[model samples]
Target: MDNTFDKKHGHELLKKPQFFFGMLLIMSLLGYVVAKGGVVSGIGILAMPIVISYVYLIFAIPNTGIIGIYILNFVAIGIVRYVKGVPLGLTIDAQFLLIYLALFFKTFFHKIPWANAKNDLVLLAAIWYGYALVQLVNPEAASRIAWFYAMRSVSLYMLFTVPLIFILFHKKKDLELLFKIWAILSILATIKGIAQKMFGVDAFEQAWLDAGNASTHLLFGKLRVFSFYSDAGQFGAAQGHAGVVFILLALSQKRSRRLKIFYIIAGVLGLYGLMISGTRGAIAVPVMGFALYTVLQKKTKLVLMGAIMGISVLVFFKYTTIAQGNPTVRRMRTAFDPNNPSLQVRLANQRKLKSYLASRPLGGGIGSAGNWGLRFTPHTFLANTATDSWYVMIWAEQGVIGLWLHLFILFYILTKSVYMIMFKLKDEEIKGMLSPLVCGFFGIMAASYGNGVLGQMPTGLLIYSSMGYLFLGTKLEKENLAIKAKEQLELAQCNK
Candidate 1:
């Protein structure tokens, strides 16, 4: 009876053979891997726990994953400079996959409001991605890898980004946050460019210049100022796009004085970055963006003022010798010249491409014309044909059909956005915020006519994000009205 008063508990792990032996086997295998592969494998093993937490974080806070994507879009290409052979791109793909996995797990407790993503923007992205996918079997395709690389920016990112934004990040605060993030990054980029301009290139940047980039980045003994971006052309265009959006933002606001100052400073920095980049086409970003922005304003007097300002800029560049001593202005001034050597070169390339693509309506393939073309299929006709313009690259790779479809999608989006901004939306603040995005988009489209920045990093993702937010403008306006109504009712009741 006394012996029955006490009981003994066995070790739980010892009781379960699977649990005991499984961990032992895993440890043994991991030890073998670390012994064979050395420190790198051990580092990876140590990092596994951290990687596993990605799902927890993503599901817990949806926008964390989304913002990660934004950060990746900015920094992905820059990784190539440091990590030589390893594909840093895998990180992006892995991040996207983890995001989707997190979203999947979230379905156990909550429904992802699919209807919010059911819009023309998402549909258009899908259609474009579908088109890119079809190129996998194109007869003219010489490199499947190139198609894989090209389509991600050309369509896949748009497809992935648009729906995620609609479903998760569609609020007004999300937009404000996005703008702030964009402005901060743009400002940082300018500062970096300024650093490079004043202090000279670092070892990595110098190495980059040594590897054929010197020809472009170091033009005629002068630095073209690529900053930290993939190239000067991209740096210039991205800055120009940001510059216009922020400057326009400052102009549109009246009450938000601090915000206005922030916008102005960011805008000015972006313009300075663009100038130092020495990419002639970047000037068109502000020119075309402001043109569209003035129209979006829908006030006759403001429109007239915008026109006057535009004409003044055009005249200043075209007619006057103002600031000819300044390298940036002198470089930008050439963009207005029809007979400029660079313009002539571009024209010649287009003509050659026209003849080559005469028989093949789909052009060469998804990645047959741009930087990827040079990498994957350098011997191909499309690869050798310098596709200076983003639209031209699309045409050279995806053909006339792709170009027309792309144009239609872009124009349709702009038209719809304009209509909503002018008549449907009532909130001045929301409308004003959206105006720069719309204008920036138009500006980028215009810039794409001269540089392949449209489908490039930072710009493509930014534009896709902007498009998604622009479509949600009406919803944001509704929320603003509801909040305002609540505030007014509370005020009246308090007075009573």
Candidate 2:
């Protein structure tokens, strides 16, 4: 056998012994716990399987590539909160570390490709990470512990995920795989949400509601229907994000009939999830997303059509009193009303925040302003006042400088994506594929103005990965065009 083949064979051969030893080690640990503690210890031993599987999955993610890890990250965030006692939510960090470990070894062995390692997006991520690190020394920071708790989602995850996606998930098929996974998950989330709406909450869900969550989740005596997500805001905005993507994907030309059908189904279900979650802020996602999508089309006729449709929807909600009897429509209608009490409250809170933060250019520090602030330093003004918007939360924690940098990073990514869609990309299919995702990102960004949902799990991951893929679209399209041109030349030469 060849040397490379023999090495690979040996690697496989070693896996069995490693597996056996792993199991033996787990059993020994369980036995020790039992010896030290008894039945209580034996009960605690149940976590061994979760730990073993979690370790196995971390190593497994590299073989599945970037999309695989994204899907795993999505699934983990979607359900980990419901899984009691295991702290499975934090295992994602382990996955991130394991990926870096694998990449390091692969590089050492000359098996890792470095060609795709450099990009403007990757550079932007590095810059963002650097800014986040500097915040550790902010003079106004109340608690370093809170920064540790909150910064993972803020800058650390972005540092690793952006480069990883650039390395592995730049292909058109990878985009399709991403769409398939996202659509399926959105549909399933809607299904679970619908069950909660029609049937009722389960034991875990009901327990959560009863344990002080009901105050926020229940509005006007109607359930918010969060489903398996972190909360109703996440569920609603995420569903709306999916709805916009799939609906636009469905409308794109040259797609297969089956794909169109799949998109339509997913889009409808996603919209339903958005409706039932009663997340009024989520309505901004589709409205703003579709507006951006139309603008990106750059066709006078399509732009006119999109404008007319958008105006009609707004007019219906603002001018007409129709459908006031329907609860869903009624709640949605409130989103447009400027004088709505909640809107007033939000504005008043912003005023208060502006007054407090006027002098602190660095703000209070990352974790000193949100839920982490409340838990770690309850007496802080930002924590008690509620930074309802993601932007507000960023402003409260990072101060003006940090918030502006974050905004500039996002704006740069979105602007670059638009520039690629408009001028650089030549393949219609590729252009069509990226347009909605970029637009959807804009929508989520807009929605985040009303809620602190963007930097949380799944949404943050989705947006970061989308940014990588959107940037990669131009590269993939150029390669595709080159191949096509070469094939045409070859055919002509053969005919001559």
Candidate 3:
């Protein structure tokens, strides 16, 4: 009987390792399949079964509630592509889907101590909803489409992504990992942009541009490099934002010499990539972001000095047209030219929007105005007209009330973040890290004056995600301070 019991225990112990090995093998195979790049059809075929199994598993193991949903989104995307009879880029899509899924699962399983709705994001959401509500009352106006666009582009995407970011990214290590991924992606984009600039538009980009009916010629016949993003505008803005963040972060880090060198190289390369994108509006983003940082630091003298230099540069560019001599500079100068056809058109559109807005204060319903609106909700008011500026789009769609809410949210967030950086956060490294984020926010706000940047994919993602980080960092800083105070008090009592 003793021999039989010992044998049974040995068998059970052996089975445990086998089960572990099998699970690892399955996970490894899934990763390999994803890396190899053709899981769409397979996912589609297994979608129904996977969904059923996932639902059952979720009920059996509540911790895995989000896994099934993540899988479902990819499967749905695949099924949509299959029905449309379009050849999809499964590799890129799959990678994004996996990242999204991982974030979702992390949020579902782990309770993020820092996650809360007390920051600027909450205000932003409120503004979005307020504007959306306004649109519901007056769906017939042309500006109404802008509201619809906001719903699809800004509101929905943020709702899906920011929560995941807040939950999954709690520690400094997580932030580092995120930055690493961002750096790698930025490098890839820079290389692609350089390639496109050096060699004319490739077959892939050409096909995409043709499909989208966008102009291929950019920067005096030099092809504007878009890489994998939606347009040159987005690519430039993303690169510019990345460049500023990298530079600021590098300056802030207390790292080894080699890592510092790498950061400098990355920053320069990212800036070069931004230049190649030929997006004039993007150039302003970094400057604005940096200015915000300086202001928050209470460097009034520095701010004044920078403003003088900036004005001088603008004057030189405006009067002498020195920028016109250089291809890249010339495009940048175009943004300042009031006579430029695009600017004139945008202004004319704004005038029309203002007249429409004056009549219907509440404005049009949500999902009524821009390209996103037309795609997501076809029956809204402002769906056809191009609402170029983010602020303008908000006003046209959601009216004054919506705009106020949106502004209020941004204002609240900025105030809170600045407060944390100034008072609560004691670490120099942490303060430095937050500088760029603050600056980026300012830059986006400035750029939004000319461009409807609030709804763009990568930019929107960065802004919302950064807000989460800012909130989390503040909470962590406060907690750390409290712990330190407690320790100090205990030590003092013991000494007495």
Candidate 4:
């Protein structure tokens, strides 16, 4: 009777066979593939580990919050251009949306703090986004889909990403982490650009140039060494921005020696990248940023130094023949010459656009200008005219009303940030961190006068994140000091 019972139980267990069919299905498919193509099967077998790792990363990244989002952002800005057939870097759009969803879902599962959500900076961003929404009914708009694509960089990313930064990244270490990532990636970009300059463009990049990009990319028999950015203009301006930020951070007396060294190296590499990009307008970024920094100091010594430097640069460009032999210097010198043919052309185009858009308060629709305009409505008036500056693009799309609002918002944030840095912040390290970010924003804003770099990837992302951090400046300093005080108190108690 016991043997019978045991045999019945064993039979029941066999009936439930867990792995048999699953293993058989997998093995059968593998076997069939191996039989069909042995080497191809082996290749797929080798790729299995990588596929598994990618799957793990996809699931794990959501836990990282803003860090993961920034990592994806870096990839989007620094790597996506090299990837073929991506159609305006769709991966960036998908990843940004995915991260937003992840953060949204995480809020339900975990207790995430809403830090500085009600701040003026964040409120301004909301207004900007709402204004973008209002543009959908723009009567001049040719395609709604075009507006969807064009508006993402203009306002959507800035709208959501800024608040996310505040909520997710609260610690001082978070600021350090962002700067380090920025510096390292910029260094890598410089290296790649150096390779392009010294050797030649890679196969993918060459192919990109071949695909009608050669007209603009290859100027006067010289390549513009864009690295992996969207274009040389973007690359150069971003590099210049990085150079200015890192250089200031390097010069900060409060930073550690190792950190200072790292910043210096990053700054040098960044400047090199800027030089190779052959973008003349990039010079304005650092000059304007540093000049503002000096003024913000409110010291006579710094003021005089900054004035001298500014005057020196002007004189060098205007009067001196020094460094004119250098191709980079030569290109940049043209920026100071009002008589430059390119400058004249740009001015002429702007005048024409002004005349045409004078009567229309809303101007051309968002997608009715620039590359979007050319792609969607090639024969349109705005399509032919060049809205080279970031402000110009805003004017073309949103008209003077929107332009003034944007400017007002920028000036408000900038003034508030300067006040916080100069008066409100007490901690030196915290002040140091915020200073570079604020100054960098100013640099980018000034640079935007030359190119439509402000509303683009990486820069747009950086600007919004900087604003969030600047708004949280006092909070961050207080939290850091409290932590320090607590540690010191604990130490004293232990001694007693």
* Strongest candidate by TM-score: 1
How much is 221 displaced in model 3, in angstroms? 2.9
Which pairs clash in the backbone of model 2? none
Clashes of 2: 0
**What TM-score would every model get versus the actual structure?**
0.90, 0.88, 0.72, 0.88
Model 1 bad stretches (over 4 Å): 1-50, 493-496
| Tens digit per residue, CA lDDT, model 1, 316-389 | 99899999988778888998889899899989988998998898888789988778989999998888888989
22-92: candidate 2 lDDT, tens digit per residue: 87898798788789877555655776687567556645556454555566655664454565554444666
The per-residue C-alpha lDDT of model 4 at residue 418 equals 94
- Look at candidate 3 and tell me the lDDT of residue 372: 54
**Model 2 CA lDDT for position 252:** 86
Error of 4 at 30 (Å): 11
* lDDT for each candidate structure: 0.87, 0.83, 0.65, 0.81
Segments of candidate 3 deviating more than 4 angstroms: 1-127, 130-138, 141-150, 216-220, 373-381, 478-496
Error of model 1, residue 494, in angstroms = 4.5
Q: Could you tally the backbone clashes for each prediction?
A: 0, 0, 17, 0
